[model samples]
Structure formats: structure tokens, C-alpha cells
Target: MPNVRPGEKPEIARLPLFREMQEEQRERIFSGSFLQVFPPQLTLFELGQHPDFLHVLIDGLVELYATSAGRDTTMRIVEPVTSFILAAVVTDMPYLMSARTLTSSRILLVPAALVREVVKQDCALMQATMRELALAYRDMVRALTDMKLRQSAERLGNLLLQQERRQGGNGAVQLKAEKRLLASLLGMTPENLSRAFAVLGQHGLEVDGAQVRFTDQAALEAFSRPDPVKDDD
Candidate 1:
């Protein structure tokens, strides 16, 4: 069972899944949820652990990673105002990856039992959950397609471009995670990532420690060959 406490839950109201829920249903959800805080590098749960709560990251960063044998790879880094592990909660299954905070975070924990019960009773919630799941599936397919079709350098180039866009169109990017994690996320060894960065420099991509930049956006884009389906965050 998850830790439950009495408190405010205004953050839950902003979730798309709850937007269309009836007032009564929303109250039911509110009554069963609680908020918790965690520091950076704290592991929220390990892979294969059963879902106890549907975590909504109201603030800070969460990294979802998976381990195989002795090696672990970053699966995704989640930003604020999003719900994670919803599929696990709805299906009453184990988490496919482990989650840890990359920065101090405040999370809303809605009990799994309540979510399961409410989702079954609330048609709107059910529809929203299905739509979220479908979007996740499509994203996974797009990520896989990019991995299969692009070379290591191209993958890293596309990622830098995506980050630049995330930081606004200023042609500047500050990587949130370390190079090792970034390499794993891009499916490359650290050495390969270094080589890729060196390659991009010739095309106007600049790397200064953790910051990447490019004033000649056209040149960089020409090398990266940006594709929306693969590059959109």
C-alpha cells in the first residue's frame, strides 16, 4: 500500500485524464490521493515492482531506466506535470522500468485500487487513459524506427536538435543528464557519443562541456535531417 495522508490535491485537477471526469468522480480521486516529496537520486521504485500508486510529477525530473544483466540503460526522462506508470496502475502490473528522481521532486500519489475502481466506473477517465496509452505506443514505435534507420551520429545530432528546440529557438541547449546517460539513451557508447559530437562540430554544431549550440541552424539541420515523427518531444 502507498503512504496516504490528508492534504490539498489541486494538481490532480490539471491532469487531462481528470479534466472530463464528473465532479463526484473527481472528488473520489481527490479523496484518495496524497502528495510526497523526494530528493535527487532517490529511487521511487525498482523494475518489476507492482504499482501501488499512479505517480504524477507536479515538479522536478524523473528518470525511467531498465537494467539487464549487469547493464542499465535510460528509457526516458520525464518532466513536470505528467503522470507516469499509468499503464501499470490501470493493468495492475509490475513496472517495466525503475524510476528515480534526477532533481528534488514533489509527486502526487493516487492509490492504484482507487484508480482501478474509478477508471472502471468513469467512462471519461477510461477514454482518456486509452488515448494516453495509444500515444505512448505510437511514440515507442517512432523511437524504434529512428534507432533502426539512423546511424549513431545521426541519432545524437537529432537529439541535440530536439534539445535546442526544447530550450526555445535560440540555438542553445543545456543537457539535463550526464553524457553517460545521454549515450545510453541515444544507444551509443560514451566513446561513440564523443566521436559523434566531434563530427557535428564541422557542421556548425558546438559542444562546450554540457552545453551544445549552433548558430548556423541550417547547416546543423541539413546534417540531422529532422523528422517530426522521430524528433518531436
Candidate 2:
């Protein structure tokens, strides 16, 4: 279970858009935001639902996915200090993907109408929002390019490399999410993930349960052949 708390005005004020806004604007936005906590696996919202709030993740992870033909495909993982489904909220359209908690999480729900109002009145806020949207679009493009150009094994290798980077290039890294979820995020089946791991083993990647230790980082990187243009950290 997750614990809920009153929304902290300072927290909302510190966000990029709010930070740039005037004090009155910041207060107005904060006044309408509410803080909530959610337990793991709780669905925050469903696909095709009208956007009501701009959900800002203060802590923990949220998985964004879409279902088609009864198969769920993981789209993106929302990390802290970020908002999800912003385009939908801004456009007053239904969400294209569903979101759920990956772990116990703290989130702030800012009313979509309020956000739209502020954006309309504040030029700086509008510019900041446009910048965020552009970056998000670029990230989506990179992800699509990665999926199209790389094999599943290579994708897994790049993911491990990213984890290693997060750990300050340490040789050892631990999987934060479950293997099944990781497989989905990488656009592969559990069986395919297993095979990818096996293939990586020959290139000096060692996996023992959730922990992964790279015996030879150079060899692994060489095998993965990651392209910086297609892969972003």
C-alpha cells in the first residue's frame, strides 16, 4: 500500500514550467494540484479516457502501455520529476496509452483545464511546454529507430549498458523492474529475452538472477555495436 500526503506547494513550484512562472501563477497552479500515493500495479488511467489531470510523478515508476488485439505493449516508463500524457491533456483529447504504477509512488495531479488556461495566458509557460513536447517527440523517434534497426539481443545489450552508465560505469548492475516487464519494454517475448541473455553471455555478459555483471565491457559493447544517434540515455 502507498501513503498519501498533502500536496507541497514548494514541490510544484520547483518544476521547470512553474519555476519560470510568476509567483501568482505558481500559486494558482499549486492551489489546484493534489498529491496522491499509489501502490504497485494500480492503474492510474486507461486508454481512450479523456484527460483530466496533468500527472506529475514525484517518486517511483509508472508504466505507459497500449493494448491491441488483446496484447499489451509497453510504451514508456515515466520517471520522477516528469509528467505523462501531456499532449493529450494539452489538446483536451483522450489518452492514447494507459498508465499504471510500477512501484509504490507519489504523484501530483494538476487539473488539465488550469494548465490550459495558464498556457494560454503565459508566453513563457507556452514556450516551455513546447520545448518539452519537442524533446518527447525526439525521444519517441529515437526509440522507434532503435527498434527498427537493432536486433533484440542488441537492444538488451544497450539496456544493460544504460544501466551500467546509471551505476557510474560500474561493472555490476541490477535490474530495477521484472524480467517480463523489461522484455516488454524491449519489444520482445519472455522466451526471446531468455535467448537474448544467453547470446549476450558469449560476449562476456553474465546474468545471475536480477544481478548482471559484465566480465568484459569492451567485448560486450563491441558485440552490441550501439549507435548513439539511435540510442539515447
TM-score of 1: 0.90
Question: What Cα-based lDDT does every candidate model obtain?
Answer: 0.84, 0.86
Query: Candidate 1: which stretches are off by over 4 Å?
Result: 1-8, 228-233
Candidate 1, overall lDDT? 0.84
Q: Residue 46's C-alpha lDDT in candidate 2? A: 98
Tens-digit per-residue lDDT, 2-54, candidate 2: 12233467666788766788777767777777888899999999999999899
Global Cα lDDT for candidate 2: 0.86
Among all windows of 10 consecutive residues in model 1, the one with the lowest summed lDDT is 1-10
